[model samples]
Target: MAFSGGFGVTAAQGATNPNNDFQVANPPNDGISSLSWSPTANFLVSTSWDCEVYCYDVQANGQAVPKASIKHDKPALCSAWMHDGSAVFSGGCDNMVKKWDLATNTPTQIAAHDLPIRHLAWIPEVGLLVTGSWDKTLKYWDARQPTPTLQVQLPERCYALSCTHPLLVVGCAERHLQIFNLSNPQTPYRSIQSPLKYQTRCVATFPDKSGYLIGSIEGRVAVNHVEDSLASKNFTFKCHREQADIYAVNSISFHPRHGTFVTTGSDGVFNFWDKDSKQRLKQMQKCNAPIPCGAFNRDGSIFAYAVSYDWSKGGQDPMASAQGGNNIFLHATEETEVKPRPPANRVGGRR
Candidate 1:
């Protein structure tokens, strides 16, 4: 491995690398935009800018043949699985949220996003789905209703959102981060003011902390300890490759059962860190394309990735180039050495 900053252990996986240790494909063209896994089932769900939902069976040698495909005419932005994995919930540029039954190729269209759908999160206990959109609003759906179950107005276009236990969080393009107490579901009992240094791209929290992590557009990250309305940013780090432009944060996921977290940046660098210490651990930096999303399940057993290149790289085709760079990572109990085989580029290289 090439050494640049510090002595870091080397791990490489990419467009043609599935990290499956089981199967690899020159991942197909989709410009994968979102991804998720059934909390209680052996399946994975993902969405692309093409308005299609791709599901994969979670087994060794598992082939990600499309489980159900929704061609909505407009682009789909993000998705999440139902509590029981029976259905898939998705939101998109169509300004609406739709639920698809995995058992059958059925779509149940619900509330409209009013603007481009940026992200969606599912709260199982309440049987509700939460969405953030460019329309400058955050809406919640009962899934049981034909319309948004509830709505909250933000100051700017909503960029990302997440719901963990007692709190429902939202990020704004203006960099404001809001926290709501979902125990009441209807109204956010509290809200926090974000620090002035960066424009936040996303926010995350583990199962064990009152604090949260924020990914910013300014190539930095911060940790905030918020309990009720009182909050403080305990630490912040310069977290991206040095460049003349802002480093956009793509996606973040907590280590299911450990004190760790991972993030994908616009610079095509994936970072692993000590969730509690705020220390950067390992980084996968080979991708020339920007990765938009990544996820890890509760046990360190399964993982998923979706890559999209920097639009300014070359072509203007929104769906071309890195659109097909999808990858799956699994930590097998048995040994797995992921070597970068540059043979005829079997996993499928750039078209």
Candidate 2:
């Protein structure tokens, strides 16, 4: 609570208006590229294209503020929290990876990539940190060691990465998909062309770690199973899009316990899906702008999403700036906006 001592203004940042269903945080000056909740606390950390990162306290019915902030020389593209929440790891367009210590509020350069580091995956079980860069390489880092333990070259630059413990899934340019077991970093367990033709925007694995979901800029999502027996169950669907206009699937997240997951897109919508059933669970009120990212708390009881202009410029609209497109929303998992509807025939009889 030391960071929250002085900056708890009720509604000063971004749009101050608040409501019952959604609570908007004091957003960054630019689009939010990534968001991650601390595994041990009711806190959230986000990276922005404004070359800064913001931390928020998300307690029950609490207002979010800029509890702590850090600025980089260039846009911070991605971030992850250490298992214990003692520190955070951030990667940026500056081609640097920094580890920010929470207690001391200091940052240390841990690794450097040849190009902008777009994605990162931290495996707590093995104490291994994997960084994927636009330079088309995945570098494995052990904080105790000065140099990377292993590096694997790829056919194309990395676009998205997801981890389920020992499994590391990487989605790269040129419609390539690779899955590696962190225990064996030399070769991928599975390597194949992405089911979707468009570039990947985001990726997330299932709660059970059986497979993963990869979303594309063309408003499509594909399910890839890790086991061959389940491969027949894999499928793809078109989502977060409008008639004639295509929007990027900016984020994908899975609920901690349920088989359900959430998808956010440049189309200004957040769609909840039951992956096993392949059905739209519910759609929340539109944000009126592109949504760059979404995240679920460790227990999956709360869901947070960033409604900002997609910095990618894939849409037909002009680029979003600080003046607009920086709203962060937090909603409960059981909120009426996302609850499944009762069967029409079971409702009050109107015969």
Candidate 3:
């Protein structure tokens, strides 16, 4: 990766130790709401409650250099990158979706919502930008058009959404799950209730595109298969919990190459899990604050995570301000960290 300016590293950036995982140089001032890595490169864009969307160029050596930043009228809640990485789309409490042209550093309003936009995903297969909002609607934008090409009224306010080619899974308020077969995007393919009891926090599709994972505020994750015949394969597991204390599973991200995944939580910790083996692969030490969001790079070689307030207590917690402010960390992933365990090593030896 090529960078034009010199980057400076602060003392806090060295706190995590550079050998394994280290802090990025400059992070947002307030809580991070979402993270998205470019589909084509090491470029990363993060949306924050500070009303800004920050971009960074992650170098080959794990050094992240600030590339640019754009502001919203209110807290920027979510962001998605264009398929070619030429631009970024972000939405926030301002109820407006803006596409930022990375080349010119200009932003254009492309869509709007009646309530806060909670999630954004770029569908390369259908060439549409999907936006989920608390207004109980899902809007598909063409980027070149002034209005949404299609608007589908959801059963409830959307909480989390994930798309993998033909499949799009949406988690909404009241534990509703709407599965969309993008091949027929006009209506719901299947509607069901979430397996977990509590509110949904995050959702991510499997790299193989056969199933998806759902994380809940109750510190549980459910592995779900799309086909009705595979219902026996669906299961839920517990994580990010200690004795007498349970933390919300804030984010779930799958490794692009291995199909194994990671879950970050409000417990200030992250763990790797293999759904096939039904085993916990690895767990990292707890950070100073909650891990609100995380994402794997294009090749799954680098894992980036945010250590900040997640609003789990319903309001701003003083913990983030006391713990050196919001920070982002990059972990150099190893084969053992994310790769699925051998069949012989798995429990029951069924795989």
Candidate 4:
């Protein structure tokens, strides 16, 4: 790959470019662990197993120019942007969480966990950074402080986490899911088992905040409601599988505006779904590499995904890396692809 200037890289198209989609310039040398879009801008941040966090400024013409990057002592597992898009917070196997100021490109350690942090979310309304770790605990921190404001124990290692204002959901190993009403952030609002039979892989809150979605290693997703009265509405559906071949559902991202969402999987496919109608909205052609993570931009105009080795088979596959699987792709969202279908045109209920 050719370098642009300073720390940035110029855009380069991929060999199997799909229509309306373009590959981002330079990507992490190893597997991508997570992707996050700034809440107030088109800027995107990605954390990877390569121990680096990268920021890119995606221009309107579909070109992603690298803006900045920072390195951790170990693989960075997850990243989340500050509310104003001025900085980013990341955590990983290093057992440390660091805040990177975009202006100066400086990083400062803010918190630490007993074990590797698996996921993190920034709760803007609460002005706290919440991190879930393999230590079987969830800790909340105010970046300005030296220690966590609060820490809650989990039943098992945290595998996935997602937050939306008053709601925070954590999916742990052993199919344990704990929901927190952030208004009462000290304790869980509810603790329950995930509907999916296998290990929980990822979780995402609905844009409306009425409920959340859980994806599992068995290629199934569960739609659940926060209220017991709406419990009947909860259901599970299958995806990221063909016949007997099943792959883990790696990531789920919701459209900031449309309330629709997408799920990317280890099978190298991503699908858009509308929970209101229990129907599939769109399914992109499968990639040659696993899509470990993805996210939609602030206004839901752009969808960015990482096409790379996910290490789903336990250890690294050198062959996949040798074929240059580390890359990012940007898909310009079309109205019909993400917009909600009319009630009349909707059909089906769970898979």
Candidate 5:
């Protein structure tokens, strides 16, 4: 192998502290709102409150940069991809959902919703898609049809949800985590429930050889037996916070190996924690605005995040000066007053 270069410091005699830190590229002064990673590739997708969605290629050491992009008519909130990576799905404040075909580089006509879409997930073993929205409803759809296959009503603000075998887990802005049984596709029965506020960042379901887990926005990570419906209220741990006040937890991704997990927080950090012991392992400091979502790469060696700009003061308020730009930074580059590296390799060295 060729000696590429060296910027990282050494930890011990042979241990290397590789430069795997984050740098804001395309830093939208508006700040990022949400992020997602491709299920089978080295690509990342992030959304900005400025009405833009960005796709990036993850570099060898895990840095990210813009690869392709789509400037939308509305700010996208939730994004996901099909199991085979043929298409991308997004739901947003515009009260619409869309399917972007990677092969055609075109989006199908927007699928309208009754309210702002807060979260979306592709059901693992089926061809259905589910979205939770401000409309206080969860709509399930068939990619082949323009209309939803089914819709479930909610009593309050619905923010996020997850799916496992025969179950659909949902959360609301009013702090409700409701579990639904999907054994009968025509009728989803509520199986469990949990409490949370607008502070819950995200929710997820994980599967392994014979076990599964569920994580919440309160920085709680829980694991249980695969078919154990007994894990309804078993979470009991918090993420590592250095100097940030974790107001909201937006997303959670369980590692593919070693059972590690990561979360994005309103406190502005991507926290990595061990699986069973629930101990803090590392931190990827980037979250600024309350992050709306996050996830890890398929292999778990890499990760991605999506953030919505902070509008807590109000929607009409002026954007922050330092973060007013509408770009999503992927990895740190030497493109600064300190010692910016002139633009060098692009396209992950592929093209």
Candidate 6:
């Protein structure tokens, strides 16, 4: 509530103290890197630059503190929960991907990369875990096997990744956008240049699997369709920019049931948009710091976003120490909050 420059009423569940809603496991010494909610339970997992992963029980009374913490030798950059929610998988700067069993709280190292593992996505239907690394490679692991099932060299160092069923999308260095059919990893089904003029920061697929949204450091988003015939529908737009500075678009997540999606940025704002209509539905409360990541629950009833200091903030006016601190925002996703309506056209109007 302290940050300025946002419109509309607050959309967070706990507005009085939004930071308290995250229920951090403990005060971390460094910025938070990633966050993922359990697919079934009201639990959440987070990675931090402090080289630790904290899992919290959000349903607990009072602030949902971390129920467990898993330490890593290097800064943990990304994490993903298995489809059944039985365990968690994390990757970090140490170039290791580890699987932690929630029942026993024991971590088992699974795979290793030459460089930092920057992104992870699990496809339950295919029983595969895909990891993208700064080493310029994409590795696929089968749950039943200990070694990677496939490894494909990328055009450049990987920066962002997203997957939905049969399709996998990766954004790498120098504006390379690569799309692969999960059934065949050796060849890419679609390869294109990102529309944005800067480094790709994040990517998320549409709920319907038609295309994906790509975010960049220049505060712009590019909408891409999978089919060559639908290429005409693709477009790019600028968002998350301030009056005097351009902020990086940090994360983009699509709602589970609705096709609408939300975007977060270094500008400290989370905005909901109907990609089909290309209109922003609502602008959520400002966090007063960069939002590193965001996610929606399996049922799309709850949305979570992480607010923390970003490397991009270095060398600017000194921020209040607390302002640079980390917290998660658990916001409610209601029909009134995200569903597009009214002059925006009828529900089935878009074709």
User: Each candidate's lDDT (Cα)?
Assistant: 0.64, 0.79, 0.87, 0.87, 0.57, 0.79
Clashes of 2: 0
Per-residue lDDT tens digits for candidate 6, residues 222-294, read 8889898999988787788767688899999888787788888988888888877667787766666788888
lDDT of 5 by residue, 186-285 (tens): 4445433453222444666654433334445445444443345654423445452344443445567666544556666655556665444434555554
Task: Please identify model 2 stretches exceeding 4 Å from their true place.
Answer: 1-22, 314-316, 319-323, 335-351
Q: lDDT ranking from best to worst?
A: 3, 4, 6, 2, 1, 5
lDDT of 6 at 32: 82
| lDDT string, candidate 4, 38-60, tens digits | 88878989999999999998876
RMSD in Å for all candidates:
9.0, 5.5, 3.5, 4.2, 10.2, 5.3
TM-score winner between 1 and 6, please give it.
6
Clashing pairs in 4: none
Clashing pairs in 2: none
**Among all windows of ten consecutive residues in candidate 2, which has the lowest summed lDDT?**
342-351
TM-score of each: 0.80, 0.88, 0.93, 0.93, 0.74, 0.89
Off by over 4 Å in 4: 1-16, 316-323, 343-351
- Better structure of 2 and 3 per lDDT: 3
Query: How many angstroms is residue 188 displaced in model 1 relative to the true structure, after the best TM-score fit?
Result: 3.2
Angstrom error of the Cα, residue 42, model 5: value is 0.8
lDDT of 1 by residue, 102-204 (tens): 7787888877866888888888777778888898888878877877878888778887787787777787876777777787766655555566366777788
**Candidate 3, number of clashes:** 0
lDDT of 5: 0.57
Report the number of clashing residue pairs per model. 5, 0, 0, 0, 25, 1
- Candidate 2 structure quality by residue, lDDT tens digits, 1-351: 222122233444333222233555567887788999999987899999999988887765546656788888899999999999988999989998888888999988888898999999778998978899999999989976778988999879999999987777899998898988767878998898888888888888776888899899888888878998998878888887677888888989887766578898887788887766556777666655777888988877777788777755755556443225576777667644344444332111111
